[model samples]
Structures are given as C-alpha cells and as structure tokens.
Target: MELHALLSYTFFLLFLFVIAGETVWANEEDRKVANGGFRPTKLFVFGDSYSDTGNNPKSLASSWKTPYGVTFPGKPAGRYSDGRILTDYVARFMGIKSPLPYQWKKYGENKLQYGINFACGGTGVFDTGNMQPNMSTQIGFLEGLIKQTVYTKRDLDSSLALVTVSGNDYGAYTASGGPEQGLPSFISRVVNQMGINLKRIHDMGVRKVVVTALQPVGCLPKQTIFSSYQQCNETDNSAATLHNQLLQQAVTTLNNSTKGSSFLVLDLFSSFNTVLKNKGDFTGSLKFDTPLKPCCVGKKGDANCGSLDENGKALYTVCNEPGSTFFWDSLHPSEAGWRAVYLTLRSSLNQIYN
Candidate 1:
C-alpha cells in the first residue's frame, strides 16, 4: 500500500511537469510565428527619412525637434514621425529593438548585437536634397565597418536589411526643375540604381533584403493642401502608379535573375493608397477618416510640423492626438500610420521567414 501511494504521487508530478513543458513549447512556437520565422539576430537600415532613425544631425536635420517622438519615448527621438518610423517597426518585426543610428555609434559601440542604422533623413538612392551621405555612401559606411572587422561574415550571414528609398529623389528632381516630361526616364534611372544597391547588399552576405516601394507623393498633405487637403491630385497619383509599376517589374526581374530572388519588395505604394482611400484587401482596420490631412501643420508656408518661432515658441499646430492622424508632416507618416502600414505589409513580410 505504501509503494502504491508513492507511485501514484510520482505519476501526478510527472503529469504536471509534462503539461508545463508543453505550455512552454507552445509559447515558443507562437513567438517564432509572430516573428515570421527564426528571429534575425541583426538588422541594417538604409535610405531616406522614412528609414532614418537619428542618423542625421540636429544642427542640420529637422527630425530632432519637438512632437516627433512625443508618441513613443515622450521626447524627441530623432525619428521623422511623431514616434517610431518604418525602420523601427521592421526592427520590431525582427524581434529586436531599433538598431542605434550610425551617427551615434560611439555612444553604444559595444551594443551591436542587433545591428546598425545608416539611413539619413531627406537622402535618397542618388544624391538628393540633403547634404548627408547618399545611399552609396550609406552602404560604404557598412562596408567600412565590415572591413574593420566590426561585423564578421558570420554576423552578416544572419542579418536582415531594410532599404527605404522614399520619394526624396523625385522631390529633388522636381526642385531642381527637372522637366515633368523627363520624370518617367528619371524614375527608371533611380529604380535601376536602387536595384543595383539591393543586389550589392545581398552579395555582401545579408540573408534577406527588403526594399520599400515609394508611397503616393501626390496624396501627401503637402500636395493636397491646395485642394484644402481634401483630395489627392490624380495626376500625381498617376505618376506614383508609374513608379510602382516600374518598381514591380524591376523587383520581378531582379528575383528572376537572382537564385532565391533574395531581394523582396515591400508594397508601400499600395498600402499608402489603401490607407489614404480607407479601402484595402488587408485584414486590419485601415479606417483612416482623414488620411490626406497631417496631424501637425506649419503656421506659414515655409514652416514645418515642429517649426519654431524666433521667440522659441512652436510655430506649428499639433493635432489633439497624433495616432488619429496619418501624416506627421508633409512627407513622413505618423507612428500610427506606420503601424497600419506595417500591417498592410504583413503578407509580404511573411517572406522573411526561413
């Protein structure tokens, strides 16, 4: 009878242990799936303000102003949005905190476990409006680090890269008085060079490289302001359509040429348009009631979202809640906008998994 009792108690303990183990296993599988696969150990970012996370200096760039990081860190965080930007979400998808910016490398030199962010605001694939390093120079920064043995070949093996060449180049072209007739040809040049940059990153041993399609420029508040921010100019959207079409073809050709077509495209064009129009085939609630209007606006035509008066007072007006608004400024999306955009890219992001 004593032995029977002991055996019964032992079996009950074993049952409990089995249940606990199963629970842990299930949780891990859920985590892996949520992360889209094996979580990448590192992430590298490149391109314009959409991906830039404090890479630009406060002395030059406007990203480090008030109301930018108000929604996230409760202070200015050098991001273009009211909080985190697309790169932050991409890093989060990798199950890692946003990598430190390239400009502040020395501050946390020992914390390269995740990766580095070399993107700068207002920069583009080729030299654009900003004086900051161009896309090639940004890649050069990574190469220099690798050459210095900061990131080993093994590290690059498990790394992921996000490249966001937003419409800064187009803005540059337009600002420089490049003819509207020449726009299509110039877009081809930009995309062709972007394709080369993508291939180069892949060749450098990155496991995956995801590049974003340019969002609808004409739909931005800056463009729609003329219509009292009520409508998007069809002509501008048509130009965006042309860009996306070429980008899709370029990506398809790139994949066809590469073995795994290791380069992937993030369809921001469709996502932005969907959110702007409040209609999409996605599952999430992309119901933006006022997508054309920004959360913050400049008092004067020359001022911007976080602009300041000479008296040091804010020269811009902020919305009651930034999350409710789409654009943080004339160009970048609000943090909430980025969150919705991330959801829209869910189907494409699944390709990141092993």
Candidate 2:
C-alpha cells in the first residue's frame, strides 16, 4: 500500500509538471501573437530626406557630396546623414535589408524582392521648390509598378510601407510667404492629404503602413542656432505640437474605420524630444553631450555642409568626432542620433507585426 501510494503521488506530480510546462509554452506563444508574429517580407519607403537612402540625383544634391556618408559606406552614398537614416534602422529591425532606391532599381534585379524607396530629399507631401516628384506622384509610381505586376497581390500581402512627411511642406509654406496667422490652416491641409495617401496605400493592398508624426522642427539645430544652440524655439515647437495632435486624431479615425488596425504613427516628435531631453543618458554607449549643436555647419554665410566655392574649395566645417554629436547638420541627425531615436522607437515599431 505504501509503494502504491508513493507511485500514485509521483505520477500526479509528473502530470502537474507537464501541465505547467505546457501552460508556459502556450503563454509564450500568446505573447508572440500579441506582439505580432506576422513578419513583413518587403518594406516600401516614402518620404523626404529623412528616409531617402540614395534616391536623389548625385550631382544635384549635397547628400551625394563628400563627408555626408563618410561614416558608413565611407563615401558619399546619398544618405543625408553621416550614416543610415530612419528607414535603414527600421529595415534592420524587420530582418530585411534596406530597400533599393527607386532610381537605383535597375542595378540589381534580386533587390526588388526586398522593396523600393521612393523618398527624395527636399521633397514633401506637396511639391516643394526642389522640383522632385510630390507625394502624390511618388504613390503613382507604386501604382504604376503594381499595374505592371512587378509586385503581385501576394507580395503586398506580406509587405510594409513607411511614410514620412518630416515638415518639408511646412517649410515650403513658410518659405513661399505663407502668413503666420494662416499656418494652422496649412497644417490641416497637409494632414488631410496625408490621410488620403495612407488610405490609398492600404487600398493598394499593402498589409501594414507606418507614418511618422512631425518631429519638433523648433528643436532642430537651425532653430536652436538662434539661441546659440542653447534651447529650442518654443514658437515652432508649438506648431509641431499642433500638427502631431491633428495627426493622431486622423490616425485614430483611420483605425476605427478600417477592418483592422493597419495605420500607425511612429511618434517621431516624442522620440526626438525624449532623446534630446535625455541627451544620450538612456542611449547605451552613445553620448550626445552637446545635443543641440550640429556636427557640420557652413563655414560662411549660406554655405551648407557640402557647399563649395567657385574654385571648388570646401566651404563647410565638419566635427572631428561626428559620432559624438546628435545633429549631423542644421537639418538632419547623425547616425548616432538616429540610433538613439531607433532605440526609443523599437517598442512602437513592434506594432507593425501586430
């Protein structure tokens, strides 16, 4: 009887252990499902310089000049930053290579399997002064490719699209003599158009679409320069705040109306603010001791990072340690800066799979 009872107790404990192990496994799977087990096979990028890899014409843009891509590819490779941009980091997290730029599509046939980048530097939701294709035109390019069956429905079903506006439209508005009082109205127009663009991309059958909320334009080195790189311009920051609030409302409407939640905002405004506020304290191994100052600047009036004199003499000043600074130029973040931003965005990016 003692042996029998002992054997029964042993079996009962074994049974309990098996059940508990299975429960743990099931819970792990549920976690994965909630976090989005569906991985994207392709990544489509659309935006301005913030996402542009090499879409801009080499001869016409500063991105293709010396000291731009000096950190990563070791030479000018059309990225506006010292290294990779937001798109590259996002693709890496997705376990895919950064998609080829639309203009460079012909160079490699196999690369098309990953995706294509339609972003152009100095371009915006609306046509800016650069004369690059507007957002509407960029979308039309994808539509044309779909028509050609370059990407079948199967391809789009497993794909992701990234759309970034990044304040170029507002820049254009202010530059073209848009009145200060009318700024809020212009911001509305931009976001409304962006909503249409997002829906169009979704209707084209892409599985997931991620768009960026406008970053703090006031915190950029250009605006901060007025404060001797000590503080951001609160007036411009207020406008960015309004833009993000409107964008969030639009995204909420999109998700509620759709069958599934396919549209998401990257919240670049918050990410930038967080990184700037922390000043590399949270970003491991990367320090931005002087977060507001740019690594490169014009040596003289109006000369940009890659500007040259009539005699072809370089007219820009580059920092000795680009990795230590946040902004690479007055306008864009360095690779280190993007890395810090990416860290903050990882949690948000996971929603793509969900």
Best by TM-score: 2
| Model 2 residue 180 CA deviation in Å | 0.3
Clashing pairs for model 2 are: none
Question: Where is model 2 more than 4 Å wrong at Cα?
Answer: 1-36, 107-109
Pick out the ten consecutive residues of candidate 2 with the lowest summed lDDT: 1-10
Tens-place lDDT per residue, model 1, 245-352, is 887788788788877647778888888877766732255454456778888899886898878887999989998888877788888889889877877676566566
Count of backbone collisions within predicted model 1: 0
Task: Give candidate 2's error at residue 110 in angstroms.
Answer: 1.1
Q: What is every candidate's alpha-carbon RMSD to the true fold?
A: 10.3, 10.9
Question: Where does candidate 1 have its weakest 10-residue lDDT segment?
Answer: 1-10
